[model samples]
Target: MADYQETLDLSSYAALGDSFTEGLNDPGPDGQFAGWADRLAGMLAARRPDSDFRYANLAVRGRLLDQIVAEQVPQVRRIAPDLVTLCAGGNDILRPGSDPDDIAARFEAAVVELREHVDTLLICTGFDTRGVPVFGMLRGKIATYNAHLRAIADRNGCRVADLWSLRAVHDRRAWSEDRLHLSPEGHQRVALLAARALGLAVDDPEAPWPYQPTPSPADLRRENIQWAREFLLPWVGRRLRGESSGDHIEAKRPDLLPL
Candidate 1:
């Protein structure tokens, strides 16, 4: 492996990929999305307060795996940070007629390149979407892609942030109103998972959710209708028109500045 400035004692971290890493739906006090990357950065920084730890998140919403490789991978290579996290392919898998094998192949290629530069390259698996609405239909594909991601991790000696095994996120509370992105608690849990993957002692990512009464059948019908109108339809329209929510969106944090 090439010389990384810090190995165990990480002084900098970077994140790459799409909306999840960009911290979608997990709003901060200022209303900015302070997704898992930011939360993990906090954990990493807290681990070593003596040194100046820098962090950057070069993730944009609605980006495909190829887009992530093209746009963010080079920046990661250039910066050569100590620790790097990559979570991609969700958007690609969401597309109609998407091939999990192909996405995994490209994802593997990205992982191969990324592992060479950083001291520790952490890659994430796709979530088990069985608990999510609409997306649940693609669970097979996502699971297939996740299997590939795990294989790639083993082959490349990269760490895995195994989102598929996280039972907490399987609950409805972990998802946002749109049922697409994670909620604040969900992002925090993901951050904890990442920290644990990095060998940090952290909270249980699988902590049980608070109690809630199951909705009636009529309530489910009403909620489904509301969801279709408010979120699903707009998403479908964007897909049909070849328009992305991230058409003009830029990475929230492009530079590897001090944390």
Candidate 2:
């Protein structure tokens, strides 16, 4: 962690993005996703129990960068949170024939707009997909987007949590069965990373994961087949029909409330 002056006064936080930020596959007891944003909020609330820590998450599943800008950004701006974390454009980059530069440009515009409303804006790079199956093909696009994000963060005053460089997220167990969203454990790790990026003191922020043995050829084949049937085909169908997982879904936590 980089050394900086310690001033952890996270009284209000707002999270904006897509399913990744919505905590897909990391289902909470109420059937809503409690992703890294929630975990980080919980931690912050814990640290300052005496303070009225509030949080609002306006992320929804399968949202494109443009959708986030149009729908979520306005709500966050209205809230005028003390801190805001934005993680979008992953869905846009995943589309067929999508241009990373175009997506990045749109993403940068959102960041510029949001940062104007809040001083502490947090951005994140997409994760590496060295081991993911079909999704691995888009690693180049993800990398390009990540590079743009770094540049945007530098030019703007936003702090970045570089998920692309986090080796732990590459583990198979870190991802859900769909290979798109992170598992609960994966969300926990990401929350730790985000907290550390915000200069919050956390225990074992750099904790290591145990090595995972490579799956046998037969096991890999079986898993791939299952994934194709369970996730890939449905995802493709949605894209073809111009539908989204979040087509009619609403934000789980739209209002800012005590965490």
Candidate 3:
């Protein structure tokens, strides 16, 4: 529970980072990547229905922490939105031989730069990938990163949307078919977390997953093989060729506009 009793006077918002912030996999009203940020923006607009509320999302898929700091942090200074939500560094840590501490330093620098400009800053922690297939191995690294992030938030007076402890997203159904990005429901769950972190009340509980029998060992092994062939192999191929899914993609909402 957020245990938040009051909300700030939120008017404008800006979201920065990688695919998670960009709203990939979760289709929006216009049928674009409308992930947690878009959903949270909707809630913010709903709070001030007749008033002017604007939001911008500058996140792109496959963006590294450095890319986010270099590209998106400057926009916060220029736009000077009332609220800013940044969720970066996942891509960097997923890369071979990347260090969580190094990524945290860059993230903190961006946070410091942003704190001066925005009224509220919400920083998301790395998700706990335990129980997932390939991502399970990354649990320890993500935990270390989350610790760093929590400390950063405390030091900088930023709010944290702690994804690691969110039980709703740990369910298998919360993930997309590829099991890399979140499914639409997962995105919705995160948006609720974001709103709660902002001291906004969220009364509804997340929907429970449908009942399913536990998978046998063979079933799991078979699924892993299929996933590796269809998703992992292609991702590895992209890495080898130094390409990104967002190489040609641009921000869905590049400028702050009325919701």
Candidate 4:
């Protein structure tokens, strides 16, 4: 790894990706999503109170790598932000018959294009799912994608926040009941990791790890049943019908605004 400059004058920040970046499941008081990108923006704002720190999030749920490249990437190029974070491909990898190599190739192309326009680029690896129940089946695919992501970042001179290596995120509590998105605490930890990856001065980067309680067999069975009924079934139904959760949804914070 190369040494990144510890200081940044981030006047403008833009985030591009899917639900993970859109802050899905991390609802705000006003019923809007407030995910890790938003949290990181807030922290950056606090760091430079005197400067005008602008941020935009152009992430929608259920977006694939192709959609992100086609739709979100152009907007970020137009914004030409001081810092940009791109986290796509997760949704694509989860789908049936998806190839990790193809995903990585598309992702690297996007990174190559984005890095040419932005001074600072940040990309993240997908989280490990070894701890998740049925989702653990995708662990190998996720690892392949993560490996490619690191290589892409290195070639593009982009920084990486290695979510796959973050042990805390493996904790079941770090995830929401849907098992797709992260909880508020999970987002917070990710935000801190992003800040640190950008070489920003962040407090409590080594925060205490979340405690994991062993669930009884009955509890596990009940939880699995609930997850299948509430989340998995709907997800499968949507896939069968070729529908998407983000079909009509627009970006939450589309325009750049002071933080």
Candidate 5:
């Protein structure tokens, strides 16, 4: 349990990605400071009290995969970080103008460039956006990106974190007003993931996770049914009993009642 300053230097790490990685909906530092990377840094600073691990967050709002390649990758190279954590691809999915296949390809290229300088790489698979109309294809596109990323990580022997599964559990409360951004609690959960993936212990285990209503199978199922009832069914499928748009099933969900 060395102090964070003792365990690592300020220049030891770097964070790269888009808005989710940047904490857009979060209250602190506005969009620039609200992301998972900041939460993770706070946790590490506390846990590794001796380590002065420095993390440079290069994520931007509304950045596409290509934008990351042209911007973030070069910064990573200059920093030459020991550990790199990246969460991207959501904007690519939501950008009506961009092709999914191309988005996946650009993500892969960015990862390749990142692997060159960073010793340990952590890439997020993105979230499960089953209910959002704008992100209808997000799940599939993320899967495609993860599959390719898996191959790349396997070849290079880097680490990959499945953020899709982590966030797959549905909770309207987990999302911010934007529906695209994660709430405060969501960022905390993400911090926990980053700590675990990097082999770092949480600063305060007894302290509640920064996020709430932890992602679990039961939660995911509940979210799915609610999602279907509110958006999917209302949009295209046969309308379910008492179902309506902009309204999530919130009471006594038979499917998740046991949990």
Candidate 6:
């Protein structure tokens, strides 16, 4: 199998996955979504200015690989996309009470379905959230999921974007308020990973990731406390007061904000 760039034309591609590919919170200029897929599409568009092709992002928040297999795969088959990028299985692996075996199976199914249609397919692995509490199990599950992805892609002659390695080695301060999701900067990093894997380039490689929101520990605490005093306390005040406040803290709590 050839590399992503060598196999498909960047101008005509499609993307499929969940929130990470949709840019749920990181909306770009003119209200364009700012997920890695969108960033990559924009980059490719600029790289081939005369080539007017379309990129379809069929991703939703909280969707697992099975959903992609059931929903997005059908549409992609109809579109007959020149290239397709998939970044699923994250929500499935991270969800509470999730079954790793099921997640891997679903991922395999998605890859199989995608391969039937697109000539060049790309699979992105998940980040290493080992530092997050109760996620030790998830780390192993992600490895298993990636293994399945690789096996399926290889068998079908598709490309794999090593996003897991990139996130593992790069600075993670670029993440967003919900440590689970990426900020605009983080999305940009992801975009670069995809671009390089596909052998494309953003107009200005140095241009920022659009929106960079840095929330420190202090910011989180302030937001949490403010939320407690206003919206939360009003509805569940007495009940929350009875519970230990520490339990409400996010998994990866930033240091206490300075008053």
- What does candidate 6's lDDT look like per residue over 183-242, in tens digits? 787777777777777765333223443455778989867966775566445535533454
Which has the better TM-score: candidate 5, or candidate 6? 6
TM-score for each model:
0.94, 0.95, 0.95, 0.95, 0.68, 0.72
Q: What lDDT tens digits, residue by residue, belong to model 4 across residues 139-232?
A: 9999999999999988889999999888778777678989889999899889988988998767554466746689999999999999999999
lDDT of each: 0.88, 0.87, 0.88, 0.89, 0.62, 0.65
List where candidate 4 sits over 4 angstroms from the true fold: 1-5, 204-206, 209-213
Q: What is the lDDT of residue 29 in candidate 4?
A: 69
Tens-place lDDT digits, model 2, residues 121-165: 999999888767888888999999999999999999889999998
Estimate the lDDT of model 3: 0.88
CA lDDT for candidate 2:
0.87
Tens digits of per-residue lDDT, candidate 3, 1-259, equal 4466765888899999999999878987787879989999998888895869999999999999898888888988787799999999999999989999999998999999998888799999988887777778988889999999999999999999999888888787788878888999899999998898888887543557688888999988998899899999999999999999989888888789998
Output the TM-score of candidate 6: 0.72
Q: Which clashing pairs does model 6 show?
A: 218-257
Q: What lDDT, from 0 to 1, does candidate 4 have?
A: 0.89
Q: Once model 6 is optimally superposed onto the true structure by TM-score, how far is the C-alpha of residue 169 displaced, in angstroms?
A: 7.2
Model 1, 102-159: lDDT tens digits are 9999999998888778779999998988756788899999999999999999999888
Any runs in candidate 3 off by more than 4 Å, and if so which? Answer: 1-3, 204-207
Where model 2 places Cα greater than 4 Å from the true spot, the runs are 1-5, 211-213
Model 6, residue 48: distance off in Å is 1.8
Tell me the RMSD of model 1 versus the true structure: 4.0
**Model 1 weakest lDDT span, ten residues long:** 1-10
Select the stronger candidate by lDDT from 1 and 2: 1
Off by over 4 Å in 6: 1-7, 133-137, 167-170, 201-259
